[model samples]
Target: MHGARKAFACAVILATTALTSGQSFADEEVNVYSYRQPSLIQPLLDAFTAKTGIKTNVVFSDKGLGERIAAEGENSPADVMLTVDIGRLDTAKQLGIAEPIKSEVVAKDIPSQFRDVDGDWVGLTARARIIYASRERVDQTAITYEELADPKWKGRICTRSGQHDYTLGLIASMIVHHGEAETEKWLVGLRDNLARKPTGNDRAQVKSIYAGECDIALGNTYYMGQMETNDAEPEQKDWAASVRLIFPNAEDRGTHVNISGVILNKYAPNRDNAMKLIEFLTTPDAQEIYAETNFEYPLTPGVAIAERVKGWGELKPDDISLSEIAKYRKAASEMVDRVAFDDGPAS
Candidate 1:
């Protein structure tokens, strides 16, 4: 009888040890697969951990991340997926990789237009698609999305490859405004005007203007603000000082805008924790951090713009639903390639 009791006690102890080890592993961390670069997202993750005692482990990659998540499917270890641009988010949704996130905090903080109509994802912040022109070489009043194609501006425009997501979205907005044929014509005309083969990111375009390589380019509003505020790169400040920002078509459709957003993975092990993180990100405090740190605008209504962002001035954004922008991505890509805009400068 004594020996049997001792054996039973050992069995109980082993079972308890296994259970405690499993719970410890589960409670200690949440996994995130992010398309946003690590530097841009680490602060938020750090803050979330400090507040919740839930540590975050992130895997950041710009490409193939969506595919990897989908491939993982029900086995995916990712609890949250954060990405910029509606196209990628929509792709994730269409691929059935994201589960609907039902949270009152998310629904209240983000606008209906910015969140998935079915609640699959929520936009956290917005970036405006705006025009940047060299103050010394171009007339600021001449700024307009259509003006980028003007013959007068030929040999004076510098932009990245049309194949890039930013340019694709910009051209997609044009398609929304003017239809496909007209957009193609505008793209061809814009192609003819390239000061150099489309090369570099938005910041590089500003650098081009500073070097007198070109006088005008299309860039995200945040990049402009970031450059202006960057004391680390005196040249970035000088480049920013030499350029002027123009929010296009304020009298018509208004300026085009895009978002950085988050979705709960379909197989998230910690759905409640994921919802909490998303809600936390949309709070006014987190929204302000997003704006100030990334040079983006808050998605939440009534949230005050950061001073540096406000200093860039107000904008009347196009009322077109961002979902509509996601819809046109493919056609926009085809139009870009058809015009050979990716072929560098025209002979």
Candidate 2:
């Protein structure tokens, strides 16, 4: 009950096996537990149902779908689980809420580097942790993660908490490259360069750069898309216009990336249908729908990224393996506390 939440739209609704409202139950259907907003995935689901005629039912929540399923135990109706962040996906595996998905099609569709080695989870799309540099103040056309620590940037950098998932993933990847000691030293330099105490989500960092509080900030690539297109918050568009994106380590190992992905529920009642859904999601067409809807990059090989995201320029994903990078997350979290990274620099 701690983090569990029942979806208000249809928490315990029975899966409508009824294909046609006027008719009885259809051939088959699947129940989906989704952390992603229903709007982002509904178009693809509608397309899938239109094609396959297999009815799909959704229980959407911003958080707690995983815990809710786990509490249901073996009787849970969830056929598939969809969420973002490999860390959360991996946690679901550790929690016994997920079952391995082994299929020749699934194996071939998702690159091994972006999925679980044992096939417990699979990445569906990608996002980069990129720098938001002031268009007017920053003169450099190129930059690297290593350079964020350089003394020249002192009092000029902004970031969310070093403890946030995005930053932790970046640091975990750094540990993979530089080992813990040197990475800790590098973190100290980055902390010293802080324009303010580490705070807020990625977009808030971009706003800091816009406000003249910092010359550069670290943020996710998709947030630029949200900011620019936001109608409710028009000021975010101005915030977006103030900075240019820089994919750190672009010339070398490439930028750090995180993913939005899926898992097969351990208690899936409609196993075959769930497998069908997962495979369908990885197809080039489905990947495009997912990518374009969220302004994210497609994970399936050769599928084009969203046109808006494309304008940021080509991204060569870092050479590190997400499975390997996930291994260092705990150490990276400890390192953040070890350095007091969110406390601002020493006075």
TM-score of each: 0.89, 0.92
**Could you list the CA RMSD of all candidates, in the order they appear?**
8.3, 3.3
Candidate 1 local Cα displacement, residue 281, angstroms: 1.1
- The C-alpha local distance difference test score for the whole of candidate 1 amounts to 0.80
TM-score, cand. 1 vs. native: 0.89
Those runs of model 2 whose alpha carbons end farther than 4 Å from true positions after fitting are: 1-27
Model 2 residue 88 CA deviation (Å) reads 0.4
lDDT of 2 at 168: 90
Candidate 2 per-residue lDDT over residues 147-213, each given as its tens digit: 9889999999999998888889999999999999999999999999998999999899988988999
Residue pairs whose backbone atoms clash in candidate 1: none
Clashes of 1: 0
Most lDDT-accurate candidate: 2
Residue 263 lDDT in candidate 2: 94
